[model samples]
Target: MEIEMIIACDDGEVKKLGYGKTVISCLSYREVWPEKIKIGIVHTDGLDATSILSYLIKVLGNNKKSLVMFDSITIAGFNVISLPGIEKLTGFPSIVIYNYKPSIKNLLNALRPHFIDSKIRELAINQIKSYEKIESKKGILYIVNRGVNKEDAIEIINSYQFYSRIPEPLRLSHIITSQISKIINPYAN
Candidate 1:
């Protein structure tokens, strides 16, 4: 059984930290849908990948590895984190989906002031492997994938997306994170 952990982040009054929600689902060919299994929350400061890793470990408990999916590579933390960092640390192949291709130039421009070497960051960006773009009757999406084959990625997206252009897990995660952040931070609207 293949399991996917879909992630989405919601920001609150806390400017530095973001509330990230992960929706875990078991994928099966028979159902052609993601079976909801678990949901987890991670509190992260901008640019802190360690917090994310720790929260995931706490949530996952026994399951050390699963296919990790994120609405974007940089969440919770402005563009302060790296996709390779998450994939390498967790040992889970990560798949990042977007409505448009990520902007390398803009990202580097944003990071230049903070980091000593923009070139190294550029190299990391270049190494990201993009599989075929997913174009369905519902919508068009760009994907950056690591550790999973192209066929499986396509299948995962197809199985999870039912009601909208966004995959069900992503949509669910978004809703969960939004509601959770509001409760966690009463000041946030």
Candidate 2:
């Protein structure tokens, strides 16, 4: 059977030094382990959707049969990605997987006080509202998908998950970003 290319992306914490850019890491895998890895930096609360799309395009190159996954839609503080934008730009399906069900009220409360950008808040709200809850062997997972049906997304997610509810590519990308964050900002608590 031909293995599907799963490209999982996650972002590190905002760096304490410099302009507080966050490291975005993508791990591409066909099976249990990653075949390729790519990393990029984006300014905290900046236009991360554009940056992420560019980074994904660079990583994807000519590979069109890939499925993109994100740990969450909101990355590097309030920098949120547009799911439909990613799907259209890459010509591939994209899914955002969450271990726990997301709270829209909490998100709204967080976004209302600090950000004046209504566009950002709107995008975030729209993305979170699209999530569908799926019950798996591991546990319940909340996911938002574009260009892929919920059944196929759940199948893909289930096949990749071995030790945890989170898929391998996402798990690895998260670990990689977290470690890179510490290395980049040694003094960050």
Most accurate candidate by TM-score? 2
For candidate 2, report its TM-score: 0.90
Error of 1 at 28 (Å): 14
**What TM-score, over all chains together, does every model reach?**
0.66, 0.90
> Candidate 1, which ten residues in sequence have the lowest lDDT sum?
21-30
Local distance difference test values of all predictions, in order: 0.53, 0.78
Give the per-residue lDDT of model 2 (tens digit) for 1-189.
Answer: 133688888887665446667777777887676787777777677667555755664465456478888988788777788777776677777889999998887887888888789556567567788889999779999999888888888899999898899988899889998888778765533
Q: Could you say which candidate leads in lDDT?
A: 2
Candidate 1 Cα outliers beyond 4 Å, as residue runs:
4-14, 17-45, 54-58, 79-81, 114-132, 187-189
Model 1 CA RMSD to the hidden true structure, in angstroms:
5.4
Q: Please list the residue runs of candidate 2 whose C-alpha ends up more than 4 Å from where it truly belongs after superposition.
A: 1-3, 186-189
- Residue pairs clashing, model 2: none
